[model samples]
Target: MSILVTGATGTVGSLVVQRLAQQGAEVKALVRTPAKAALPAGVTAVPGDLTDVASLRRALTSVRTLFLLNAVVPDELTQALVMLNLARDAGVQGIVYLSVIHADLYSNVPHFTGKHSVERMIERFELPATVLRPAYFMQNDLQARGAIEGHGVYPMPLGSAGVAMIDVRDIADIAASELLRRHWAADPLPRLTLDLAGPDALTAASVAALWSEALQREVRPAGDDLESFEQQWAHFAPGWMAYDMRLMMAAIQQHGMKPAEGSVQRLETLLGRPLRRYRDMVRESGQLKLG
Candidate 1:
């Protein structure tokens, strides 16, 4: 069965493509630019856009499984609905959707709210699907790597709250498992929804301490104020995007992303191994250079 993976160039999607291809699965990657996709040798790169229904139809040909991953855009709901309808029309048998944790609880956050809408769409269609709602990405710290390395500070707006963040790689592993697991034509289809998180729930200060120990520098939490976070992103992001990010962060600061019971254990069972620790990710990435 050929699996069509959308958002194939993104962090999680790219890793999923690589994992599926390495496992000898026939993987088709949907990308805006096939020339720049740079997927593995055996993986097929199909040029398509979620907004372009015609293009998606062309890409979905002979595709049995679909990994639907959409970016967080203002029109995310529209794009996802268009893609979902197209995928169903194309006779795609199974789908694996990447979503955020607590999407229902944080409806005000545009990203979470958008994902919640898509989740409902999948359920309404009654598709043979597995929905993965992963907690915060550990790799998000890479955006603030410069601040941690140069200024020795963790400058996120996550206040004193703890988050059970998971690595994007683990999320990819789970997605691949769903797409690649063997199922006969007569076998019962599994409709699953899983919430994934890391083994440890770490706060901002705890993360800073990890960086400090890893880099041999006194890294500390820069501040917990939303205004400072807004200012930091505003310098590079559009005004509305900066505000959107601030809104999301403020919610996290106020109500931490604590995982439900058995979330980590379930993730580990899916991955067939222990979840990757934040400190281990930093060490293996070779980003912990001493200053």
Candidate 2:
């Protein structure tokens, strides 16, 4: 049976599709535009939108497993429900959902709330499903490239809060493996949710230090107050998104965002090796410039 990957053009979803295809699985990628989907050679591209049930149904025609990842948008819960209903109707056996860490704790963040809603829906459906609650993406560091290059600084409101940031590629690997594994591979197909994280926790300052060492240059950490940060980002992000970002940052600052012990072990067990570290991601992305 083929595996259908939603949001196939996104950071994690794209890697999931590519890895599944590389592993010789019959991969079907659901993309909003087939013209722009540069999927791997053997994967099939189907034009579909997660918000449109008809499009999702068309994409799930013969697929057995699905990697469901959606972008944050207005009415995300409604759209997710539409997609879930269609998947159920289409007889898809397994679903692997990408969720955020501490989704249960930070219900105020719209994106995390949307993911929690989807998790509940998946449970209600009682279909074979695996939910991966991963920490913040280390790839987010790439967005600071301009700042790193121009001013040698990394700025965020995370403060001294340390988080076990996971690389998107590691999450993709786990998702692909879960989707491809036989139903009876383990009794009852394991638990519903898995918390995937990197090997170590690091604060914003520690991250800046790692980049400084990697680049052989001073990398400062800076951020305005949360209110100011929200106001500044509101100019570029939607109002709701800006608010959610601020709330999420505040939660991270107060709660420290670190994963529980053995979270990384779980990821390592799934991948049969240690997960990639943030420093590795920086080097791989060529963002680490050595003096």
lDDT per model, in order? 0.85, 0.81
Deviating ranges (above 4 Å) for candidate 1: 182-188, 287-291
Q: Which stretches of candidate 2 lie over 4 Å from their true place?
A: 182-191, 287-291
| Candidate 2: Cα lDDT at 236 | 89
Which has the greatest lDDT? 1
Tens digits of per-residue lDDT for model 2, 1-291: 688988888899989888888889898998878888898998999988877767877888988887888788888778777887888898777788887889888988888888898888878867678988999888887987887757988877667867888888888899888888732244335437888788878787888888888878898887636897689679888888888889988888877676767777777887899899888877777756533
TM-score of each: 0.94, 0.93
